[model samples]
Target chain A: MSDPCIICVAITGSVPTKADNPAVPVTVEEQIESVHESFEAGATIAHCHVRDDEGRPTSDPERFARLKEGIEKHCPGMIIQFSTGGRSGAGKARGGMLPLRPDMASLSVGSNNFPTRVYENPPDLVDWLAAEMIRHDVKPEIEAFDLSHIFQAAAMVEDGRLKRPLHVQFVMGVKNAMPVDREVFDFYVRTLRRLMPDATWCGAGIGRHQRTLNEWSIAAGGHTRT
Target chain B: MSDPCIICVAITGSVPTKADNPAVPVTVEEQIESVHESFEAGATIAHCHVRDDEGRPTSDPERFARLKEGIEKHCPGMIIQFSTGGRSGAGKARGGMLPLRPDMASLSVGSNNFPTRVYENPPDLVDWLAAEMIRHDVKPEIEAFDLSHIFQAAAMVEDGRLKRPLHVQFVMGVKNAMPVDREVFDFYVRTLRRLMPDATWCGAGIGRHQRTLNEWSIAAGGHTRT
Candidate 1:
């Protein structure tokens, strides 16, 4: 219990916009300001996703570089974690910003259903992303949307596709994907520990289930993302 | 221990061909002969897949109808189950043969990574296939490639997208999909029972793990597919 809990703040995800919430930071400067505020509030990691001029999600590396620079300047020592999530782009575009070598990047090691479509992380794409992370010395924050993804991450680590001392995030409450079930959440923690004892994991819940995951994860001695 | 087991034989999958094994049946007559042999050897269920003239997998309803008729004549009383698997076709084409209405059709309720690509069974496609199966009076053998698929099937049954008294199949040993693990197999059985108390389930393991799943399933009081 004496160990510090790392608070990761996802300032703006790919889906939400000003229409959804006017407080959602879109521009690089706004994102930097928001992360600075979160950093001041004791958050140490800034999970980032950049948007285009029209405020649509994009994986443009130049925009990411600007965001990274702004964050590093505004919130010193804060972890910069870019999202390689499918929402931002398609195919190799998704990994275009990995070369920026932020402190870390969110990697989805397995595929699952999103609200409307299949969140496809094909095996090759996952391997390629892992390779990119390794080449760039960017630590991966494995996004486990389902039970098997935890196993998939363990396998990748075992096979050297991913490095050890893994950081995994259990995502729940997405429609058509894994729902926020306490029993399943507990199983995720137990399975991750069994698969990779040295691994540090976190839990993320979408929308109304967010508070529940944060509380459960905190109580269970795991990290939480807000 | 005294429950009679259902011996299901997958005569020809979409992957293996005559190049892989000369005994692999491609045409309707070949498939009929193969099923008849398996039927004589006590295979109560014949899991069928059809190939075009060039030996490529297809979801042609005419071919499926011919195969169904041939099996009905040759393997009398044996169950005919067609594969609505992704390898055979894309989208609704995967379920084209359902209208022919064999005894059953395999249905994947979720998406996951295959060795080379994403084995996509999108939410809408799964819903469509399940609806087709229901419309055609074709019982679906729910394919549980990953753990969440079991839950998805349970949810479908709960919502009447799929009828109750479910029959589910747990597929393992795919390259990038679920690996053959005894503990996972045991958990699958336990979870299925917990989710759908009246459900009957089976275990299918690929390649060298096939015998292991068959043995484990029989020893654990579930069905086995070869």
Candidate 2:
């Protein structure tokens, strides 16, 4: 029998706003409700990003705490994964919520270009975020934007910077970065399995490619994020 | 019959100095002499970087002109390719020498991590450099530090931002970046071939892995740099 697929629901990404999609939950209360609904729909993980009063993305630990509390209250047994992505904050601010000790957190192990700019994840910053995750005993879902990021994650695991039995996410369709291609997607899965045989991976796509990635991930025996 | 190998000689890189290696060319005259020697030793392309009076890397067009003149005079029929790499300069200064219009210039289409910092090549800057190269009639040697770069190059070509018949370099063994792995090197070659069948490619490795990359490139029917 095929392994059971883990479904992660990203209720509010840093880039999307209510203007982009009316149903995108911006407030903490709405986020909790959306995640609760997702959990009832069989989603086990909630990949989260918080917004400020004006609906702008921020790395405020207070906002993350409230959201975490709401999720725990409403959706028991659901995993909470905070985003340490560059879009919400700069430098150390991106990892400010690590001390909250969410069940999991997104970690970009290397830098790459986004649609409009270069996503600046310097080596020292990556090291610091990884160290903070270790201190807080939080699992990192390695965000593999490019192929080298997967290799970097493996290197970190080998050096004990990250624990074994890694969990990585293959992100695709970001302009100026990796686009959604079947061959490249297959190569990513093959490379990850070769490097970390016991590791688990998820596939995520930006904009219109989200459903395509979900289907591909399910067919490939990996996880998918909505 | 097999295609003839094109040997490019990078006489002086931005990071290496006389202190790092006593043999590294520092002055323009020393660089010209080094290129002359390499040209005589069957190197057809000269990958050049200029230094200021105190031996610091700079994007000064005047120094580049002098070096270009010296190479043309001393090494007849040699291809002079200037280094527009980030280590030598920042922002538009990195492409300041493109107006000189050497036979070719290096171009990085995406961003990735360097040893201790981010090698930033923002999308706008990449487009500007590509436009300048087209304006000056200079061919670009697309520097692929990671896998997405090759895809970026192909995208640029498809969008008419970059001309076809591209030449790319597969760089490896850089700390905090892509390391020298045989499987990855092969994948890079395969991906490039699948994306742009008419394009030419070369292999480059930093530090001790340079010779290994040379052998790999030559054995794989691609070019190499020393």
Candidate 3:
């Protein structure tokens, strides 16, 4: 038997131009199908980023509610992972879609080159995001890119903003960001493990990087999902 | 100004099949051109793993001599890095290549899963390799993957078998081995830093893992060449 674990299919992650992938699934009806298909394909988690009707990225509370309700109705036991990532003209990203109070939300510590602009998450933003996740009864999946991010995440856990057995994603393979080399990956894992000995973590790759570290995750006895 | 770093061109390493890439040079002539191209394109290091005359992987002394002569005549001052990774035949790697003792040699510590085989780098072999590198004025680069590898490398350095200002390669994203994710990469860096605070290390990727960590190396500000 395979591992009875949570496999989250991150849908509509990269904000695509219409010229990119047409099947990005922006509306509620389309998101419902996408979640249903992942459920049928044996995923226990549905990681989502909401977009407008015309396919523009949005952090509108109503759209998030519609997407959550649709997914919950279509697939009952699936975990709902809402993104705190806000696109252009969406204002500040921290706690942007937290009002809906999904089962889980994403939180990143430290600033990185997120496409054209930096995904700026100051220390205060992390504390606020963690507090909101606790308030909304949502589990915050800590996203980290470099060494300092791990340190920042630990600070949140220590300050009582996050609970123990933390879940983190060692994101890699982004251009002008951290390199996804084996020794670096080994170091990345060791540093976090040293800092928070018992934290649960996963590995992710930008673009096709998901192709490699996911396997490393499995080898290292960490949970790796598609 | 751009980074004034020495680039290492891996003309051919141990882990490649015909199905992987056809451009993997297998002969002295091909290796010479590969080195020449690398020098012309801003590389100052050539990490070599010699193949037999028939294009199959081999570690014969004659082939090593030919490769050295070719590099000396074609691209002088370009550093040569040889591998202790031997073949399955001839009973635990032929012992002649070590005598040539190039400018550098790779000493991969810890056991890891490579392809279908278990790469067992016993502690005894590590000590022997370290001693060999020290004897010949060849710098020993401790190659590692996963957390255990980091631990082993640190132990080797602590034992005084490996030299100071430790040189290492953060190899990431290889199948059946540790990954090249940001978390893994940074963790490795953190662990190494804690053990040997001033160590200089670089990174590498396998197959299609080209520039991911290379750019990360530049941004993170360490030894970015490997």
Which one wins on lDDT? 2
DockQ-derived CAPRI band for the predicted complex in model 2: high
Better of 1 and 3 by DockQ: 1
Model 3 CA deviation exceeding 4 Å by range: A1-4, A86-93, B1-226
Could you tell which candidate, 2 or 3, scores higher by lDDT? 2
- TM match of model 3 to true structure: 0.51
B-chain TM-score, candidate 1: 0.98
lDDT at B106 for candidate 2?
97
Per TM-score, the best of the predicted structures is: 2
Candidate that beats the other on DockQ, 2 or 3, i.e. the better one: 2
For candidate 2, lDDT tens digit of each residue in B1-226?
A: 1657899998888888788899999999999999999999999999999999888999999999999999999998999999999988999999999999999999999999999999999999999999999999999999999999999999999999999899999999999899999999999999999999989999999989999999999999899898
Lowest summed-lDDT stretch of 10 residues in model 1 chain B? B175-184
Residue pairs in clash, model 2: none
User: Whose DockQ is higher: candidate 1's or candidate 2's?
Assistant: 2
Compare candidates 1 and 3 on TM-score and give the better one: 1
Residue-level lDDT tens digits of model 2 in A89-129: 99999999999999999999999999889999999999999
Angstrom error at residue B224, model 1: 0.8
